[model samples]
Target: MEQSGGPRGPEGNEEARAAAHCYRHPDREANITCTRCERPICPECMISASVGFQCPECVKGGSGTGHAADANQPRTLAGGSLAADPRLVTKVLLGLNVAVFVAVMIQGDRLLDELLLFGQAATEPYGPVEGVAEGQWYRLLTSMFLHQEIWHILMNMLGLWFLGPPLEAALGRARFTGLYLLSGLAGSALTYLVAAPQQASLGASGAIFGLFGATAVLMRRMRYDMRPILVLLAINLLFTFTWSNISWEAHVGGLVAGAALAYALVHAPREKRTLVQYGAFGAMLLVVVVLCVVRTAQLTG
Candidate 1:
């Protein structure tokens, strides 16, 4: 082809001549060609022989690198970061939990009591008062993020930081977040159901414990030996049972919920993914509902 400025051959114009000059020195003049528009691009613009000379337009259209990543393709943890920064997300979650814990503590016992009870204890004549009653059933979800003590929040967040990343990396952020929240709700519901009707509880331990439980199950699915996980679970269970006022119900419930959620959410194909995820989520919700109903009955009866 020809252009107004000059012929469009390899060495037709000043730009082409310069490109040829560079290419000749490198003994690569034969491979320079515009990939986009096929304008016989100069060596300066030409990428290489393997991919051909991608024209400016083509490069722009290609967007940054060479091509867009497939949306469905799962991304592996890159740059050794998968392991090095494994706890990065967990750290952020930890910070949030700690901050909330402090805020609850500084607000004093009156506010702390109401905060711990959330909205469920609103009508109760004793125990912690519920702060935001009515339409705040959402607190069951939010309560997982609020802890009353430094050690309580720290322990939970640390557990999450240690345990959450591997699962998150395996499952993707969206699924991992969903499991955490849902598991926390399940944990809280179980606590409320099994404990004194007026007892108040608060902590991220339920969600963190859920992550541990889920990881244990996923590890098993991945063909890893379950000895270490079993040991850890046993230790946590022992602690729960031995510790006074630890809300063992929440711990065990969250653990089971997390395991179920992990089983449903991880390593599934697109077609069956929805079925598994929704099924697990629905089942967990059903358990929570049953617990709530049973608790309500016990209180009324």
Candidate 2:
């Protein structure tokens, strides 16, 4: 077909020149075609390709994948970061946990009494007097990010380092972060239910366990090996059961919550995946809140 601004063929033989125009700009002349799709593209619409220039569509699809991705735009994901920087969520979460741990170390033993998950229902409150009477519920979320010991934070962060990137890349930053936090909250909720109200508990282990459960479930859906994760979980569970100090309730709660959320996220319908996943997670959070409310009622009653 004759392209815009294309000259006549030599010797008046118009059939000798096969002209192609840019798909987007039908009026613009295009000589070079995309290597992947073989679509004609004008220089203005071309992007630098390893071999040759590619059309905008080919680049958006990812350099390797044939399918197209969304146009270049920053999207909000978990932890309120732009979509391109999914790793940022993981880094920030890890950084916060480390910073809190450092603060705990510097502040000495008193910090745990103030920061640990201590229910208002406890017979004798361990957290701050203002927190207990004022219904400072932030402990559930804050406790998930706080750790007292070097080895404890190190182990949990190590688990996050191994498990975080893949999940972040797959689920996007926001969803992954939501999973981590909700699982942590669930852990605190369960700990509140079973542990003594005055009992002091703190650490990211609950959140870490949640990540473990999510990774294991997602891997199973992908037909990936689950043995390693299962063994790890089992060993950890054994430690929780055998150890005098370990909060088994929190571990169990986080594992169950993470696995449930992972299941919802993985099986969510492709048509409304994000909506369904978040809605389902919101329902799960509601359940946690209900549990907290009921547990608190029992304590107060």
Candidate 3:
């Protein structure tokens, strides 16, 4: 007698046959086996290959196994899950900014001296910026996430909520985050170079300007109408120049950084895409570091 799921075979008097079935679709009888694994697979599970049909398992087995080599293909660590949703980066950024803002509100003016990017304002004539001269470069990054007032936080976060998702999706999580942080750092670098040592500056405007520039550049690259973004940028520039106590230097620096970074990402050749993009980003950051060193020397001298 032949088993229920097994293919029919010649049987001698009272002998039993072992049942065979598809691994994936157990209910369906397997007509063919995978060429590589030799495992039984139903019609739906078959993947046509050059030599013979393969099972779905066999095809997916190459991922992260060093067997596949495609530059643009997404990589996965061993036992790691799939790529995260693109929007996750945006949400996390917004959350961190908001949380820091609340902490600033609670800490009052106490945290300002530590968090705000005050460049020379902390030096000799203006009095030393506490953490910066003490080898704390983190203040530059801290200022980007700090918002002094409720409205300041609101406007910046609103801009992030509005613009971050699409940009994140286009750039992928790592690239998008690199663009954002580098842009903000560029803003602070410009601020350190130009702002009066005694003048304090904080807020996300510079970083926000970066996103604006990125959006415009990305849109232009995609052959989409950039008029709306251009108009919006113009309006913001007007505010940046006209508004009191705003660091136009940071805004412009961030805009330039973001645009440059986005350009590298958008135009990089597919074959050397990652290498080119990261190299451009590193070069942009190196320029900022040089600017910081030069400004520090000038201030100290």
lDDT-based ranking, best first?
Answer: 3, 2, 1
Q: Runs in model 3 with CA error above 4 Å?
A: 1-84, 122-134
Candidate 3, residues 258-281: lDDT per residue as tens digits? Answer: 999888886776556678888988
Better of 1 and 3 by lDDT: 3
**Model 1, CA-based lDDT:** 0.62
- Candidate 1, residues 121-151, lDDT tens digits: the string is 5544664444323334555666788777667
lDDT of 2 by residue, 75-157 (tens): 22111123555477789999999998888888976776567787753324563343332376788888888887788889889
Show pairs that collide, candidate 2. 77-174, 78-173, 78-174
Selected candidate, larger lDDT, 1 vs 2: 2
What TM-score does model 1 achieve against the real structure?
0.65
What is candidate 3's local distance difference test score?
0.71
Clash count of each predicted structure: 2, 3, 6
For each of the candidates, the C-alpha root-mean-square deviation to the true structure, in angstroms, is 14.3, 12.3, 13.3
Weakest lDDT window of 10 consecutive positions for candidate 1: 72-81
Tell me the deviation in Å of residue 110 in model 1: 3.5
